[model samples]
Target: MRLLITGGAGYIGSVLTGMALEQGHAVTVLDDLSFQQDSLLSLAHHPRFDFLQGDARNPDVLGPSLEQADAVIPLAALVGAPACDVDPDRATSVNLDAIRTLLELRRPEQRVLFANTNSGYGSHPDAVCTEETPFAPISLYGRTKVEAEGLVLESGNGLAFRLATAFGASPRMRFDLLVNDFVEQAHREGVLVLFESGFQRNFIHVRDIARAFLFGLENFESMEGQTFNVGLSDANLTKLELAERIRRQVPRLKILESVTGRDPDKRDYLVSNDKIESLGWRPSYSLDDGIAELLKVCRLMPRRPYRNI
Candidate 1:
């Protein structure tokens, strides 16, 4: 398979790219290098790997990449609520506008696997969100992803994966994600002040996200023209519960709750991954598995800029 991955040098993208390469697929990566990290450097000598440094919003980049792609994975974006909130214009341009551009320009035969966020089901703590759940996005980031997801599904050749809050370590690591953030904080400060600690959310390992994309690609015939919630079934956890999990790995980590506190992202939803799991995909990494791995990395690289937003 020939795969074109936009923002393929990013945290999840880098992981996906490597996975695809290992699976004997030809991979092309298009990334703007906005984060200034050389996460893809290790793949420089791979025979099947190709990379183009560029922006997804630019037709000059998208046009040529789409031309060579058998499957297109649009991963480029100003990801997350905090990042999107900081620059709404750029967020809209990358997250929403670029997707519109892809839909308009992509060939009918080409397959598109879009990266959508579970954040779209905002603040639904009382219900478990599925692909059938109505989107109630609360942040600019989530809203943009929701709008983009609609475009992909309506385009017959496309498939959208509404991803849960991803939380495993990646080559291009991120500490902004809840699980990673809490674990890192506990390692560094030994204390954490949590707000909206009772908010529940779903999580998936980063590598599992990559696997879901591959699963969608391999089963594109049955999965096309649909949206699926991709997440770990056993990993639905509240913020307070997540902290407790982290504390188990990093002992003596004091957790302070603030009832008056608020989470700016405001994403609180328990998502079901049964829809995708039925298609023969399952997550291999558990919360404990990820934390154990992160703990080892923390000891090796104690202080690196791992947060994306």
Candidate 2:
């Protein structure tokens, strides 16, 4: 298989590109390096790997790349609520319109496995969110992904994975994701604030996320036009619980909760990965495994003033 991954230097894409190459797939990555990430630099020597430094929104770049693809994994987007809020137009363009353009450009026979967020299921406090759950995305980031996921499913040759909030380490490190951010803060300052500490959300390790894409590629024929909630079923935890999980390793960490502030992302729901699991897909990395992994890696990373996740 020849794979063209958009934003291939990103947190998820960089991991996916390497994994696909290891499985003997020809992988070509297209990333503008908006975050200045050199995550894919190590993979340059692989005979099956090639990379393009360009924007996904540009057809001039995507046209030639898509022509070479056996499958396409569109991972380029302004991820997370805060990033989208910073620039609504760019977020909508990159997250939604670029995908719309890709679906229009790709050949009918070419498969598309999109990286979508489960944050669209805004808040179903008492119920578990499956692939069929209604999307009530609170943030622009979630809304854009919700719209893009629809386009992919309607494309007939596409598959969408409604992903959980991903953690663990990646070559392109991010301090914006909840678990990664918490672990970094705990290890550094030993003190952090929890806004909406009781709000629940699901999580997945970054490597496990890459595995999900690989799974989708292998099962593409049977799973096309479907949306699967890819996550750790037992890992539906609140902000406080996540911090406590981190505190296990960083015993000196102090957590303080504020009642006055409101969380922009009001999503509070447990996601059921049973849909994908029933299809023989399961996550190997647990939340504890990810937290411990971060503890070691975070120490080696330099503190950046801004994060793009």
Clash pairs (backbone) in predicted model 1: none
Worst 10 residues of 2 by lDDT: 300-309
User: Which residue runs does candidate 1 get wrong by more than 4 Å?
Assistant: none
**For candidate 1, lDDT tens digit of each residue in 1-309?**
999999999989999999999988899999999988899999999989999999999987899988978999999999898899899999999999999998888899999999999889888878988888898898899999999999988887999999988987788888888888888889989999988888998888899999999989899999989989988788898888989889888789999988786666688888898998888888989989998988877777788867766
- Give TM-scores for every candidate, taking all chains together and pairing residue i with residue i: 0.98, 0.97
TM-score, prediction 1: 0.98
Superposed on all Cα atoms, model 1 deviates from the true structure by an RMSD in Å of: 1.0
What are the lDDT figures for the candidates, one per model? 0.89, 0.90
Q: How many backbone clashes does candidate 1 have?
A: 0
Q: 1-309, model 2: which lDDT tens digit per residue?
A: 999999889999888898899989999999999988789989999999999999899888899889989899999999888888999999999999999889999999989999889989998889989888889999998899999999988987999999999998888888888898898889889997998898999999988999999999999888988999988999999999999988998999999998877757787999999999999998999999999998888767857633773
Show the colliding residue pairs in model 2: none
